[model samples]
Target: MSQDLYELSATELSASYAAGLDPREVAESVLARIADREPVLNAFYVHEPEQVRRDAEASAKRWASGTQLSAFDGVPATVKENIPRSGIPVPSGTALANPPVSAENAPVTDRLLEAGLVLLGSTTMPDWGMLSSGVSSRHGITRNALDPSLTTGGSSAGAGAAAAAGYGPLHVGTDIGGSIRLPGTWAGLVTLKPSAGLVPLHAPYMGRAAGPLTRTAADAAALMSVIARPDIRDYSTRPYPSMDWFKGPANPAGLRVGLQLDAGSGAEVDPQIAAAVQRAADLFAAAGAHIVELRPFMSQAQLAGIDAFWRTRSWADYSALEPEQRENVLPYIARWCAGGKDYDGVATMVHYNRFAQVQQETIAATRDYDLVLSPVAPMAAFPAEQPMPVDDPDLPMAHISFTMPYNMSGQPAATVNCGFMLDGRTIGLQLAGPVGADDKVLAAAVWFESVRGDAALDWARVL
Candidate 1:
């Protein structure tokens, strides 16, 4: 192959395997890429190259005998460290606790292994997966693959960096409040946060989900096809349905798309990001889709309520740890979690109840449109050392206003790179749909990709 194997998409790898391409060679290419980029990016918490080689060799033999486990057999992939895989200790981005090796695979890990995708290893995250930035106690800072000075947004931090740096085609990331999409924006990739519970998870929360972060929408679709299978472990998920993820909407014609420029309250949207999203909307309008401007659906009260509740939640976890263990947590995360200690039961309940209001408002606001478009985050990439765009523990969630609402609403949202900054940083456009509309959201992303064309940043030129 003229192009390096490390750069092949999951779709391309599947075809190559079917045509007798050795999985071992692909693994070697991936390993080579990791060797070149991992030192600079710090993208992986646990990467065992020998294990990758062994897995690939097994896959190569399976391909030789035409006994491959699935269509994507032997494709390289990585899982976020937060996701449990048997025998892998899930540090969860904090050194505060000594976690045991998992006895069983999480639904996402099980599905990927069962599908014959070679597990490249686990990526890193921030403390307890709380922060939306890459500054972590356990893994340090995971820099953006596009620019080392900037962050690879988190808590799916390493997964984003790995995907952007060509660390293979498939990466599994968990998102509750823009973890996947924010990083994807910074890295210029396709990130899908499937409707809550659409993808089975072991410890299902109200809005937490596991989805793919990949270079292309097609690869994200390929991953979803495998991981979206229903598992009895997660009771929160909807019944699995058959869907053709590869095919997108034929065109944008006749679709009513809502353009949401304001996030209600938080950091103001950057001018460049705003312009990029407007340009994206114009493109859709040109294709005959009816574009409607949307008013802000969120408010500072709602943002504060969720923030208070989450802080309390984090404190509950921190309080359970030993005193020494608590000290090991990152200072920013520790201070953030400490804020929860001041809340009384009534205050806690009041804050927690805000999610319902957020859900109601989000659904009501977008119910009229087939899809909504907004900037994934308020700003482009920021310094890797900071925990969030605002860089304040008290205002930790100020940047998530746009992405957080959908999680509360249980809507399906995706981040597809729509444009780039003059300096080459990516601007992600969030495409979201109503609850249970995962298929529609992904289909729209695929359609957008068709017209968005190639990204300006060169993947091969990563520092």
Candidate 2:
């Protein structure tokens, strides 16, 4: 089980020790690789070098005694900046969102560490982690690994780029509305948005959940077992499953699959993306699942509007900033939510009710299908420095139009790369499941992986 620096999966690296590779050597090799790439990628926001060295040093001892913590033992991983890292501010991707660095590890980070993965550092993010384009005025924008000219999807931009650029195999990324999936799609990696409440969210804004962004869907399953523990800090999280995401126990045969061919965005989907989705559908049919193309029941406006409650993000994020630094925040976000503006207490409740109604209707409509499939991001990546090409003349880009609905409904969802667009950018297919169906979603993603395998595009080949 000897492995090269970059090719082994997170699970494989842990398994290598069982087959004879020294876990400490693998850990050291990962550190060297991170040092080699950090300058070019700029992926981390707050890295803990001495702490990580100590953790790896301890893991090295465990390796010699043949008493590793588990399969992911000694594996290197990074957390998004907003997730509390015990000493870093929850800088939610915006300059205004950073308060003092935290003094204790957040529940999610504490659980993951207890599972044996060393936290290398915090990955960079968009301010408040809300901006869809992945640009951070405070920390320079994260560029797509495939094409520096293209924007990395956010607000999990750094996690996405870090994986594609060879920083690590497993990392955690939150997704309210495509934050995890879009970045993974744009950067050509696999990501999971577990059902709300499966992964605990102790942050005030995240309410009650979180998820993983990884190189493969199988990695997501491994991460779920690590981070899905109940947290008294966030009472809403469910009890950790005795065993989660172990595949082959359930059969995929005759599963009814629904493909939302058009996601009500009204934007003209690039033909290449549509073709890639169709190919995925054909493959599913050949594998014995029944695939049906259906017009989805939800609309973009209805889904986007759900942010009123979930994304009080702007206000929840920026209001905590110092008065003077507030002006330096991202202009659009600051202007929209600053000065004690935006919503009154009453309006906020009404908005929440309206959003809930939409969720009820969407869930009722989608219940018949075991898995619902759609394109991850309607459009492909754009330049890193510019705003998305919204005024493309032929089509206007409404970022998050396709992803926000699941956030509203609080469903478990994920992205799987299927093919490359004509422009050479990657296209991903999203697979979603009912709320509380976290294991089911990961199982389907793994089944999708067993069939399509990994994506074919290489960074050097495209950008």
Candidate 3:
């Protein structure tokens, strides 16, 4: 029964109640799975089994009374640590002692809870979400579900790990750069970084968006429909009308796609990763979609500008911490924060201006195409507990070359598991669309997933 419960997706689990399976029984199976796996994967930072059981019992009662809230009622889901959930500590992946618990739920959390999705716990992330690798000073490191020696990627580290390890079928993670995609790519899952303002963000910053990491693009679309609903709290929330994201596009029979194999910069992509992306493009071409090779739209200077913006923003957060608390942060994160201390207002503004120009160029370059395709990262997951894959300590941006450009442009982008490397690491093919074309982007992903079949799904279940 536990094995059968573990195999069910969130959508399937929700429907199981109608098939005579109690939500409480399913919840117990999930808790038991976590108890067996959490010690090795380190996927969750804090989970209250008692609280989860109580919520499950309530959901079962609702089911018995024919008062379920949504299709996801009684489904298990995990939230990233940085997002606030009432009564859970928002550690933000830091080692600070007795971090204050959240007094209220973040907008995303509220939506999930209101839908009756059971909160499993908060997942781990790098300190202040500063690094792409899974290592963190607060919770040590999150190991890849496929291989214990490899990283799960970050700052959505544990969310990816939890999803890959079969803790649940739905998980939420935030992406400022490649946080969600990086982990999704490494963990052989599908993740979407919805366009800016699609998901209500409190005190939003440039390039930051909250989204889902799941086993299938269809599941991501389902979660997005609920979370992207209008919230009055986020002043920046777009007034866009809601659509049936779960249905995606009816088909991708006549879409135009632009493909870029390399960034035209010094960063090199692994052959396996590039091949996987090409295979995805080929699949689209076979589906009657027009595919054109595109030149790099972003320059080295533009990339540097984006990096500077993030560094400056991170520094501001780090510098605001109490001196002793600052010392508790990961050394790499601290160093990154310190690197921005010397920048004057003028220099920072110059970077912002450059970033704006880059964003415009990116939009204009891909405007003719319905979608853009590329590798999610330059390579697969690297060694666990490391900051990056490169031997050079100075080139921290090497692995992020492919995904960060979309973040700067505020476009909707998603990464789907396309294939795997010889060393057992997964490769992700990225699908991106212009700002506010999130549905189109996800539709293309779903179409590709249909063609790709369930190879990645089978791999994920290897646990």
What are the RMSD figures for all models against the true structure?
A: 1.3, 3.3, 1.9
lDDT of 3 by residue, 15-75 (tens): 6876767888888888988998888889998899999999999999988888988888888
How does candidate 3 score on lDDT? 0.83
Estimate the TM-score for candidate 3: 0.95
TM-scores, all candidates, are 0.98, 0.90, 0.95
Give the candidates in order of TM-score, highest first. 1, 3, 2
Residue-wise C-alpha lDDT for candidate 2, range 339-433, written one tens digit per residue: 32467888667656756766776688678888888888778887786534353212223656566667767778788788887777888888887
Q: Report lDDT (CA) for all predictions.
A: 0.90, 0.72, 0.83
For model 2, where is the 10-residue window of minimal lDDT?
388-397
Q: lDDT winner between 1 and 2, please give it.
A: 1
Q: Deviation in angstroms for 126 in model 3?
A: 0.2
Off-target runs (Cα >4 Å) in candidate 1 are 453-457
Q: Candidate 2: global Cα-lDDT?
A: 0.72
lDDT value, residue 246 of candidate 3: 66
